[model samples]
Target: MRRIKTRVFVIWSLIVVAAFSLVGCGSEKQTPPAAQQAQQVELNISAAVSLKDALAEIQKNYQAKNPNVKILYNLGASGALQQQIEQGAPADIFISAAPKQMNELEAKNLINKATRKNLVENKLVIVVPQDTKLNITKYEDLSQDAVQKIALGETATVPAGQYAQQVLQKLGLWDKLKERVVFAKDVRTVLAYTETGNVEAGIVYKTDAISSNKVKVAAVAPEGSHQPIVYPVAITSGTKQQKAAEAFTEYLFSAESKAIFEKYGFTMGK
Candidate 1:
């Protein structure tokens, strides 16, 4: 009878232990309501390639302050980003290198127009490989024989290329150099071409040219040679995280962000 009592006690103890273990497992699998509510949010930002360095630094700082927020960047030419957003890409914020791309989105009601603001400006520059001995010191020198291939972004989709086209056209070099122009997908590509010595010269944003150690600025396009180079930021109309996106957009204009941009050779937008 004592043995029988001992066996029953052991079974009850095992059942209690199993019950406690099940409760612990259930608790471990569930997140607190407050924690679930404060879940991490990812904001998708599509920005011009020229804004890459500045934006990346800004993102790091912003995330440090807002620990629950994560920023994902899709950097490319402004026009290409615009097209992606138009095609229903999951972009929370859009920062374009040119007003033209932003304007197109605004016209289509794809972005919150009220949220649109000019963020920065950049200058078009001619860059050459650091070790280049090419005599192309100025934009006009591209017409010289030694400078066979000049790299510029594809004008149709690249804002830098469009600006380069305007400068070249204004200087009466567009038609003459068009045949030798090595069109790139983006300004970074143009920078790469120049950096690798694949092209005698390339046109890119002053910020991009300065970012690379392998390239050096040969000339800057005179002001007014092209349309004003403005970087504009806005929240997309389709963004579900409007509040977070707006916060990010405002953070971009903050002193900290502006200083970072300036450090990268970008000027404050007018």
Candidate 2:
């Protein structure tokens, strides 16, 4: 009986010794994460403010797939963002809400033209407060005396405002309604004015109106009234992280990103 017990103890000791040897071998063979990972790249993406929610979601999904890459966003009015890039802001990529900014950058050779592609499209819209009793439901309705205050983006620095201006001009409402218009710094601000009932009506992108519950879309600008609202994206010519910037720019056209954009009320650009 003692001999049997001694034999069992000896077998367990051998098993334990073998397990330790295997662990030691694995420790020597397994490479540290630092040794296996490529150099980390940080990409600064300057994009339109209307893209905030969609891009945030895309960023989360992309970083999960690319552990070696980090993303930072500089979001604001497209025209303002373009001016910053022109002034040598540290942006690796630029996504403009309208082609005007991207076109200007390409003319100045400030962007990698070859990498420029239309990313998504938006609709210009008119919105009013949800609880308002006003009968306003169209762009022309703003000309009514009851619509005393109107919100519009500043055309010089805001693409939505530029489009809104074009639509009003084409509809011949610009001259009559210009006086009542209160131009905001950005499209989101226009939405804010409408939400608070500070303005009887506001002009903004469909995406901006969708982001809020305090206001409801009153009208969609006639299709041919303005230039097509398309967002274009490209890597900046001065980007030091070209490899990473290109990777992300390419990812923007992927199916995963298309779903995210559509979910945010933006149609993918052809």
Candidate 3:
């Protein structure tokens, strides 16, 4: 009888141990795998204000595809954004309306050189209020006596202004138009001035003119009047989100991004 009891006890102990082992295996299976749980990341994109609409669409598309990544935009004048980055403001990527701001950052070693690339091309144009009797049909017309005030981006900081200056100088109208020019804080402000009829005319990008029905394109800057209007994008040297920033910048040059930009009147740069 005692031998039978010992056998039964041993059998019960083995079953208990087996049950615990099964539970351990089941618990291990229930745990989520590290690979399945992606780490969430945030990327800050400092882009030109002119890119606002296109980028808004692009961001929605990208975020839909990449649910784990969050994108926040810092849209403003390229020069102002460059200054902010230079002064240690937080930014992961920088997209300038022209190469001048990017060149300045590159010279200062503030940008990731390997990630730099020209993103898009734009045309500078003169614009006026949609319903105007100014008879402003060309760049030459901007110098006429009827044109009391003209709005331009501040040449010291705005690339559009710099381009306008170049075009004016090329056309030999810089000296004559200098006194009539009203310096705006940014290209969009120049557009605003024209839209509000605060200025008789404004020099801005063709893309900007397409954004508003309140303004009409007077004339496009003649080819070779200024440097090629190419926007350049790069990662900031001090960015903490290196890989994520690179991924977003790569997306900016992707076919989908190109389509969005084209829809907004921008031509992709080679």
The Cα local distance difference test for each model comes to 0.92, 0.92, 0.93
CA RMSD (A), model 2? 5.8
Which candidate do you rate higher for TM-score, 1 or 2?
Answer: 1
Model 3 regions more than 4 Å off: 1-38
Best by TM-score: 1
Ranking by lDDT: 3, 2, 1
User: Which number leads on lDDT?
Assistant: 3
lDDT of 3 by residue, 87-139 (tens): 99889999999999999999999999999999999999999999999787779
Our tally of clashes for model 1 stands at 0
The superposed Cα distance between candidate 2 and the true structure at residue 260, in angstroms, equals: 0.7
lDDT of 1 at 132: 86
Tell me the lDDT of candidate 2: 0.92
Give, for candidate 3, the lowest lDDT window spanning 10 residues.
32-41
lDDT of 1 by residue, 83-141 (tens): 99999999999999999999999999999999988899888899998888877667898
